[model samples]
Target: MSFARYVEQTDPPRPPRETLPTMYDLPSENPEEPGLPDEFHDFQPELLRITFQPPTHLPEQVFSASDMNLYYNVRYPNWYKRPDWFGAVGVPKLYEGRDLRLSYVIWQEGVSPFVVVELLSPGTEEEDLGRTKRRNDQPPTKWQVYEQILRIPYYVIFSRYTERLQVFILQAGHYQELNLSESKVWMPDIALGLGLWQGEYAGIHRLWLRWYDAKGNWISTEAEQERQRAEQERQRAEQERQRAEQERQRAERLAERLKALGINPDDDL
Candidate 1:
């Protein structure tokens, strides 16, 4: 029977959980249908993962993944969704507190992602924006997985082509589109904000999605922080050299004055 017909004929209105196929009932991936992520997809997610820092969580307690299979439903052990980038605050960085994870299984981790980001691609734009419809008996679309099933707190979509950013926050059991006038969205619980930054990342100069602190400062990657520290040191050294030059000139003037008085400057020295 069609899913619509099944719903209407049932004596009691059945919840989606009862009528729809859960994550476990679906396959994780299709061998024939492979994902081909472009350059923007590769670089943008790395930037987000590197800059993800939750103020209240330790490095060991916060986990972030890019293009990793995220297994969501307990009943559908093999069913999973792969997010472009996703972060969880309360989970250990290592799987089972020992080895790195091959995939993020929600049932084992006991923590849903705090935030998810999708770098819009030509192929997945409609589903990413929740504009696509799911067929009956098919696994839920990416939108359904993140919004209805996982209930991720923050959902972000960025398009490098237009340099546009969209943010959604879950409220009252539904995702609400947020108006980002400044092209940024702040999450107080995580003490961080996400925004489009125009700067060089990975030697590529373009607008990219990055994290910002609560005080409105862009969180720096390790390489960026190192470069900044090196620049500061160079400035300090230049200032010191200028001070030394001034001191030497003053000493030379004093020596010349002593010589004019027929007194050896060496004696004073």
Candidate 2:
């Protein structure tokens, strides 16, 4: 089917929620899928979601998901892609501004992802990087869905095993690999930069793909921010205590000097 025709029909979509399966009706997962969420898969996306704050968008206008089924086609309502993590700006935090989304239906939502991240695993490395070919009947690979169908602005892949980061941007109607300096790429549209940071996430000390602010500071997780605030408070308290102690010592010296000069230290003025 032509893309134009798909659009014509989907403007008042008949194949998605009203006529065909919606997120609530569609099955989210299959045990047969090659790549499944492991420990890192769980932690990394959580970190991404927490740290992703677009300067231009409101909190309600930005939404991020991990391992959620993203249905793209109105023609093929069952066709879906489960990106490791995807962020969409200018979309409701809930499905249609009220209900929580069980899955991200592109046709229904009427927006493509701003950025999609695929956490590479050994089992799915070939397909994740667009190396493997799909049979004619199979749904398009993750690359085709994100790059061609969805036309997502940014595509990112990170491998924990090798500690490598790769970013691709849609250019000239195709994805072009971007040259990264220090394993970092800035998405100006999103007003955020992503890079590899050597630090502890969820108590695991390793190099991880993390988001950075415009100043090149790693966006802190909520817990990390809380810790930083606590530290600041402690430092301020310590400084105040030191100042009080110094004042007390100075007052004692003045009293001693007055006593030596035959003037009672406690005398009324």
TM-score of each: 0.87, 0.91
Q: Indicate the TM-score of model 1.
A: 0.87
Candidate number of the best lDDT: 2
lDDT of each: 0.83, 0.86
Q: What tens digits encode model 2's per-residue C-alpha lDDT throughout 81-191?
A: 888999999999998788988889887788999999999987779988988765655766778778778899899999988888989999976789998877999888878
Best by TM-score: 2
Give the TM-score (vs. native) of candidate 2.
0.91
Per-residue alpha-carbon lDDT of candidate 1 for residues 113-163, written as tens digits (9 for 90 to 100): 999998888888998999988776667678878887788999999888888
Backbone clashes in candidate 1 total 1
